[model samples]
Target: MKKYLLSIFTLIIPIITFAQDSTAEKFDAVFKEYTGWFVEGIFAEIPFTDDIQIPWVLFVLVGGALFFTIYFKFINITGFKTAVKVVQGKYEDIEKHGVDKLYGDQTPGGNVFETIKDDGADGEVSHFQALTAALSATVGLGNIAGVAVALSIGGPGATFWMIVAGLLGMASKFAECTLGVKYRDVGEDGTVYGGPMYYLSKGLKEKGAGGVGKVLAAIFAIFVIGGSFGGGNMFQANQAAAQFTKLFGLTGDNAGMYFGIVMAALVAVVIIGGIKRIASVTEKVVPFMAGIYVLAALIILFANFTLIDDAFALIFEGAFSGLGIAGGLIGVMIQGVRRGAFSNEAGVGSAAIAHSAVRTKYPASEGIVALLEPFVDTVVICTMTALVIIITNFGGDSSAISGTFMQYGVEVKEGVEITATAFDTVIPHFSIVLTIAVILFAFSTMISWSYYGMQGWAYLFGKGKITDLIYKILFLFFVVVGASISLGAVIDFSDAMIFAMVVPNIIGVVMLSPLIRKELKKYMNAINKKEDALEDGATDLVDEM
Candidate 1:
C-alpha cells in the first residue's frame, strides 16, 4: 500500500511538467478528433426509415434481453420473490452453513464436504453489498437524466415500453451474473477475479470454443477498460462538475477544475481500498442517493395525486398511438427500449463483475440476486423520474415539445436540469438538492467504475499489486482531466465504448445460457431440499417435545 501511495507521484510529476499554456490546448484538439472518429464508426445507426433509426447495439441489447426473458421462463417475474429472499439471506443454510444429516455431513447431491471446503463462502461480500455495488454503477444519470431524455422525444407512451424493456433486462442480468460466478476464480487470499472475461474464456472453453471465447474475453476486457475510463468515470465527472459549477454560479470551464480535483481525491480514498471497500461504500451510498431521489419524486407524485391517473393514461395512449410522435409507434417504442436497456445495462455485463464477488456456493443464487438491479434502477427509480415528467408535462404545459431541447441556453443535454425542474415544480429550489444528488451520483459512479476498470486492468496486465496501483493512478488522473476539460466527442466515444461491450458479453451469455439454466435448476433444487430438511427437523422437535 505504501508503494501504491507513492505511485501517485509517478503520474503527478509528468502532468506538472507538461502543464504549460498551449500544450493543454493542442492536446485537447487532438484527443477530440481521434475520439470523434471512433464514436462515429461505433455508434453509426442503422437507417430504418427517413425519420427513425436505431443503433445495432440497441437491437442486440433489447433482443438478447427479450430472448433471455422467455428462455428463462419469465424468471425475472417468477424468480423475483426468490431474488428478494436471496438478498435477505433466507437460504443462508443452503448456501453457506450446511444442512446437517442431509447427506453424511453433506447436502445437494452428497457433495457437502466438497462444497464447504472448496466453494462454501468463496466470495468477499454479502448478497446485498454485491447488489448495491452493481446498482451504484447503473442507478445514476441514466435513471435521473436518460429517462427524461426518452420522455422528451417519445412522450408519455415511452414510459410503458420502458417498463417492458426493464423487465426483459432482468432476465439478461440473471443469466450473465450466473455465468459470472460459475466461472470465477477466487484467489488463495480470497480476492475474486471474475466477469465476462472469465466467463467467456472459461465457460465457452468448457463448450469447446476456446479460441472464440478467448478472443471475446479479450475484446470485452479492452472495451470495459476503455468504458470505465471514458463513460463510467470521465463522463460522469464531467456532467457532475457541470451541474455543480452551474448551480453554484461558478464561471469558466476551469471553474470546475478545483471541484474536479476535490472529487477525485474523494474517489481516490475510497477506491484505493479495492472492491470490498468499494462495495462497503456503495452499499451505504447507493441506498442513500437512491432514497433521496426517490423520496423527492414521491413528493411530486403524491402532491399531484389527481394527475396520477391522467399520467398513466397518457403513457398508455402515447405508447400505442404515438400520434404526435414522428415515425409513429415504432419511434416511441425504440426510445423507451433504448433508455431502459441502457439505463440498467442488463446485457452490457458490467454488473456481472460486481455480482461475482458475492458470498455464495451456488452461482445461480448470486444470479438471482443480480436480477434486481434492473428492477430497482429502471423499473422503480427511472419510472419515478418518468412519472414526474409525465405528470408535470415537461414541467410546464401539456404539450409535446416544451422547448426543453432548446432551453437552459444550451444544446439539448438537459437531462439533469430537466429532471431537476420537474422536481422544483413542487419542491421549489430543489435544483440545489438535485445538483448535490448529481454530484453524489457522479462520485459513486466513478468509484465503482474504478473498481471495474481495475478488474479489467488486472485481466489484461496480470494480478500484481502494482496492477492496482497503476490503474488507480491513471483512473484518478482521468477524473481530474474529465472535470477540467469539455470534450463532447471524447465523452461520446466513451459511451460507444461502453455499448461495445454488449456484443461480446451477450454472445458469451447466449452461448453459455444452457449452462446458466442447469445452474439455476441446481440452485432451486437445493433450495427445495433445504426447505424439506428444515421441515423434517421441526417435526422431529415437536414430537420430542
Candidate 2:
C-alpha cells in the first residue's frame, strides 16, 4: 500500500510540477470556463424557494438541519449548558463508568481525550482537542472570504439567514456526532475508527438493511476521501497561496507553484504523525488564530460603533424586502444559507470524523459538544466577517457591489481582498495580520482534513501503516498541486463530494436516531441519579482533569 501510494504520488508530483509551467494558463482558462458551465448548468437551476431558483444542495442541507432540529426537540438549545459541563469534565464519570464493564481488559471504543494523551481508551483526543480539530477544518478562509462573497451577492440581508441556517444546523451536527460515537469501532490495538461510514454501514446492518447500508457507506467513504484531498487540502492551499503571493506582490506565474511546494512540505510533516499530532497542533492553533481574528473583528465593530444599529437595520431590511439589491428575498436567503453551510459545515459530516475520536461512553455527550461548532463557526465567526463587510459599506450603495451586472450570476469581487480591505479600513497594516491568519487557517484545515481523508482511505484499502503513509503522501502532494495549478474543476467536484456525504450521513443519523435518543435518555438518567445520590451524601463520580 505504501509503495502503491508512493508511486502514485511520484507520478502525480511531476505532472503537477510540469503542468505548473507548461499548462498554467491553459488550466486557468479551462477551469474558468468549467466554473461558468457549472454555475449555469447545475447551480442556476436549483430552486431556492417555491418561486425562486437556488442550488438543491442548499435545500438538502437546510431542510435536513430543520428536520433534525425538530426531531431532537432542539437538543442544541436544551443541551448547550450540559455540553459545556461535559467538555469541562463535569460528566466524565458518566462517560467512563461503563467503559471497563463493556470491554473488560480491552479499552472501550470512545473516550474524549485519548488523542492528546494516551490512556488506553477508545478516544483519540480530548473533547477540547476534538473540537479544535473539527473547528480547524470548518472555520477557515470561508468565514472571511466566503462570507464576504455571500454578502456581496446576497446583500446584508444574507447575514440574517446565515445565522438562521447556522442555528438549525446545530441540531444536525448533534444527531450525526451522537451516531458517530455510538457506532464506533475499536481495533485490537485500541485504535478507534468511526464516522458516518461506520455508523451508516454498521447501524443499517443492525437494522436489517446490511446490503444497502454497505453500498451507501462505501460510496460515502469514497467521496469523503476525494473531498478531503480536494476541498479540504488542495483548495485550502491554493487560496492561502494566492493570498500570500498577492500580499507580497509576487508577479511571476510560478509564484503560486513555489508557494505550493512550501505549503505541501509543511503539511506533509504534520500529517505524517496522523490524527494525534494533527489534533495536538490544532488544539493550540485553532484557539489562538480564532482569538486573533475575532478580536480584530471586534475592534472594527467598536471603532465603527455608530454603524452597528444601521448594520442591523440593513440586514433585516434586506432579508425581507421583496426586491433585493440584486435578486429578491429568496436570493439573499439562499446566499446566506449557502455561505453559512459552507463555512460551518453543519450537515457535511466532516466533523463526524473528528467527533468520532472523542472519548465518551455516551454518544450524546459529544453530540452536545458538536452543536457548539456551527454556532461558533457560522453564527458567530461568519457573522463577524459579514459585519465587517457590511459595516465597511454602510454609507455606500450596496447594489454597486452586487454582481448582478456580470453574466455569471451575482458573485463577490475579490472576496479575500474585500475582507482585507474591510479590516485595513479600521486597523492599519491589519492585512498583514489577516494574511498570516489566513495561512494558519489554511494549514490547520489541511492537516485536520488529512486525518479525515486518511480514515476514508484506510477504510477503502486497509488500516495499516503502509496505507496510512500512502494516503498522507498523496494528500500532501495534492496540497502542492492545488497551490501550483488552477483547479477550479477539482475544487467544484470536491465541494460536491463534501456536500454529497450529507446524503448517506443524514440517512445514518436519522436511521440511528432511536439509538441516539436511547443514549441521551441513559446519560440523563445517570446525571439525575448522580444528583440524587449527591443530595443523599453519596460520593461524586467525576474525576478531576
Candidate 3:
C-alpha cells in the first residue's frame, strides 16, 4: 500500500505543480470577471431585506435544526448535563451491556480467540477524544479567514446571525450522530464501520424505505468523498501552505507546491494507520491548537476590553440596519449564516462520520455530545475572531478601509492578513503567532477530514486496504494541487458537495428519527431505573451498613 501510494504521489506532484501555475493565472482573470457578474446578479434579484436576505439554504439548515430541536423536545439543551456524565462514564451501566474486554492474546482475525482479543471493550478513545476529533475538522480556517470575509461583506450584523445559526444547529448534530451510533456496523474482528452511509442505508431499510435510503446514502457518500478530497483535505493544505509561504516571504510561486508536498507526506504517515491513529493525533493536536488560539484571542480581548461594548453595538446595528453595501439587511444575514453553516456544518452530516466511531452503545449519548461542536466552533471560536476584527475597527473610520467589493466597512483583502493585523494592532508580532496557529489548525483539520472522506469512499466503493490507500493518495494529491493552484472552482464545487450532503442526510435523519427517539427512551429509562435502584439501595444501606 505504501509503495503504491508513493508511486502515485511521485507521478502526480510535478503535473500538479505545472497545472497550478497555469490555473492560478487563469483563476485571477476569471475571478475578477465572476465577481462583477455575481455582484450584479445579487443586486438584480435579491433586493435584500434583513430578515429575508438570508439564503434559502440557511433557512433549510436552521429550520431543519429547529424541527429536530422541537421533535426531540430540546434534547440538545436538556440532555447537556447527562451527555457530560455519559462521557465521564457516570452513566456507563446504562450504556454498556457487558464488561468490555480486548481480544485475549490472539492474532488479527485468526479465530474466535483472535476475534475476542481484537474485540476491544467500549470507550476506545474517551468522549473528550471523540469531541476533539470532530472539533478538529470544524474549527479551522472557516472560523478565522471565513468569518473575516463574512463580516467584511455582511457587516458586523453577520456575527449576530452566525450565533443564531450555530445555536439552532445543535439539534441537527444531535439527530445525525444519534443515528450514526444506532446503525453502526461492527466487524467480526471488532473493527467498527459506521457513519451517515451505514445509518442512512440501514435505518431507512428498517423503515421499509430501502430504495430511497440506498440512493440518498450513495449520493451522500459520493459528495463526502469529493468533500474529503477538496474542502477537507486539499483546501486545508492549500490555505496552510499559502499562509506559511506568506509569513516567511518565500519567493517562488511554486513554494506552495513544495509546502503541499510536505503537508501531504505528513498526512500520509498518519492516515496510513487508519482511524485509531487519526483519532489519537487529533485528540492531542485539536486541544493544544484550540487552546493556544483561544488563549491568544482572550488576551487580545482583554487588551481591548473597553472596546467590547462598541463592537457588540456595531454587530447588532449592522445586522439589522442593512446600512452597508450589498443587497441590504438580508444579504448581510445570508453571508453570516451561510459562512457559519459552512464552518461548523451542523446539518451537513460530515461530523457524524467521525463521531460514529465512538465505542458507546447508546447512539443518543454521542448525539448529545455532538451538539457541543457548533457551539465551540462557530459560537465561541468564530465569534472571538469576529469580535477581534470588530474591536479593532472601534472608534475608527472602518468604511475608509472597506475594499471595493465589500458591502460593509470590513476589509476584504488578505483575510488571514487582516486577522493578523487585528491581532497585531493589540499585540505586536502577533501575526507570526497567528500564522503558526493557522498552519496547525489547517493541518489538524485536513487529517481528520481525510478520515471522513475515506469512510465515504469505502462505503461507495468497497472496504479494503487497497481502497483506503487509493483515497488517501488521491486526498494527498489534491492537497498539493489546492496549495499550488487557484482553486476557486474546486472550492466552490466542494462547498456545494458539503451542502449537498444536507438534503439526503436530513431525509435519513427525519425518516429514522423514530429510531433515535426509541433509543433515547431506552437509554433514559435505563438511567432512571439505575438511579432508582441506587436510591433504594442507599435507603437499605442506612439500616445495613
CA lDDT of every candidate: 0.83, 0.79, 0.76
Return the TM-score for candidate 2, rounded to 2 decimals.
0.89
Model 2 has a clash total of 14
lDDT of 2 by residue, 93-154 (tens): 65765433322232356544334243433687778888899999988788888888887777
In Å, residue 66's CA in model 2 sits off its true spot by 0.9
- Tens-place lDDT per residue, model 3, 254-310, is 788888888888888888887788889998888888888889899989988997887
Q: Per-residue alpha-carbon lDDT of model 1 for 1-545, expressed as tens digits?
A: 64654566466545633542466667767887767777776777999989889888888998898899899999999999999998987876557643342322333455434333332567889999999999999988888888877877787788899999999999999999998898988887999999999999998899999999999999999999999999999899889988888887899645657776778888988998888999999999999988988999998999999989878887888889884776678888998898999899999999999999887778999999998999999899988998887676543545443433322112246788778878888899988988888888888889988888888899999997877788888898888778877656667777888998999999999999899999999889878876775666632111100
How many pairs of residues collide in each model? Answer: 1, 14, 9
Model 1 residue runs over 4 Å out of place are 2-28, 35-37, 98-119, 252-254, 394-411, 538-545
Error in Å for residue 325 of model 3: 5.4
RMSD of each: 4.0, 5.4, 6.6
The better-scoring model by TM-score among 1 and 2 is 1
Off by over 4 Å in 3: 21-54, 98-124, 323-326, 397-413, 537-545
On lDDT, the stronger of 1 and 3 is: 1
Over 4 Å off in model 2, which ranges? 1-14, 22-44, 47-51, 99-121, 396-410, 541-545
Question: Per-residue lDDT for 321 in model 3?
Answer: 75
Summing lDDT over every window of 10 consecutive residues in candidate 2, give the lowest-scoring window: 400-409
